[model samples]
Target: MSPFLTFKTFYTNPLNIEYFYIFLFTFLLALSLIAITYISGKIIKADKTHMAAMLLGCVFPNSGNYGAPVALFAFGAMAFDYAVIIMVIHAFLINSIGIFIASFGSEKSTTAREAMQRVIRMPVLYGALLGVLFQLLHFKLPPTIMEGISLVASATIPTVMLILGMQLAEIKPQLFALRYVNSVTVIRMVISPLLAALFVIFMPVSDTLKSVYILLAAMPVAANTTMLAIQFDVKPNLVSFTTFVTTLLSLLTIPLTIYILNMM
Candidate 1:
């Protein structure tokens, strides 16, 4: 279950204006990455499928499963709140803009209107929206129901980890292409965090929140991206391979990113 459905920890609180900074920062991050990927694709004369894979790998990140836990451990429970807020924003952007990119990259060839129709049909986007709407109306689910929803949400971590493993396992080692894999990993693991570090400098937020955002941006190529690539037939192998490589690279990059942020 997507955490967006969790009524309590996720959306029960009234919306905070401070959250806008998180939204803005992530939006800028996604836009910058999309531009970089798109422009770089044009430079390399790459096809739409490969560019889409690059966009997914570079723009969206594994903020939910990988990043949230890292925040809890690295900065204590306080920073975890910042992480979830960012995760919610990430989910919305990825599900909406991500669908557009995937559909555009598909061999079936879609019109712009058709792409938006796909985005609208996504239930996850509606879940998040409905959650926000409920919050604005000061509506709360009964405690008995909230507990049941929380129970399902609690299972998300383990289930997602299992799915992550399954996705990686399905990748054929022989099909791995080094040059493209390196390209995506460098953008995801290196460039994304640097851009985040700079983005947070001007954001009106606590230092702790800034650090949390940077670390989340520094996370690996999103696991969700591989599934999207597979579904759209948009270089699934390259996306999967890049996901695998960036994840392995994060073991080094995350710790280093944390250390550098602390020094600042």
Candidate 2:
């Protein structure tokens, strides 16, 4: 079964409310990470454009495609539930908070009303809400419609990755020269997992949840951040380059992290 289906099925269980702490945990952790990255970027004297790019590339991860598989490989299929749950949270946060941050930090000055409007209009937020509602209400979609939706959902990650690769190809000659790209890469692929370890070490959740958080955090920058960048005109090339760099580096870093999580 798909990771998202696994996630939905788990939540739809009548007794699943007992595990709601995991959602709160992820929400707080995501906010903290975003805040820390935003402050750090400012402290480093990054310009608004770079700061926005840093927040976009560093705070989010490729939790669906890259993270879920890694969770399955490293911790077994049972643990995939946690990975998918975190992915859902990440998606919601990216569409709402991530978009707000990007808008606030955009090169063009934006008023509070405009930022709020952007977040409100993001379709991903609505989709996330509807997913939860459907699961909770036990609303069964028509078979053919569900199948088409599944097909489209399955295509999200690969499609974003392909777009990222193309954007990177265009920026190849100046990839390294792109301001804030390296710092964003390091923060996303390296510091994120480290912070996840620290976050989980003090939590009272089960080891399975801990493993999922670490693996999810260890994922590379979200490829869809490039799409957000392009959509918001928030330094698309720099964000895309950061996404490419971090994903390329995660091949080594993810395994290393899986080893660390295994030891814990």
| Steric overlap count per candidate | 0, 0
lDDT of 1 by residue, 107-212 (tens): 8666678657766776556666777777887787888987887788667667766777777777665565555676788788888888998898899888899999
TM-score of each: 0.87, 0.77
Each model's lDDT comes to 0.79, 0.72
Report clash pairs, candidate 1.
none
For model 1, the run of ten residues with the poorest summed lDDT: 3-12
lDDT of 2 by residue, 138-187 (tens): 88778887776667655555654465456556644344453477678777
Clashing pairs in 2: none
Q: What would the C-alpha RMSD of candidate 1 be, to one decimal place?
A: 2.4
Tell me model 1's lDDT, rounded to 2 decimals. Answer: 0.79
Candidate 2 lDDT for residue 38? 76
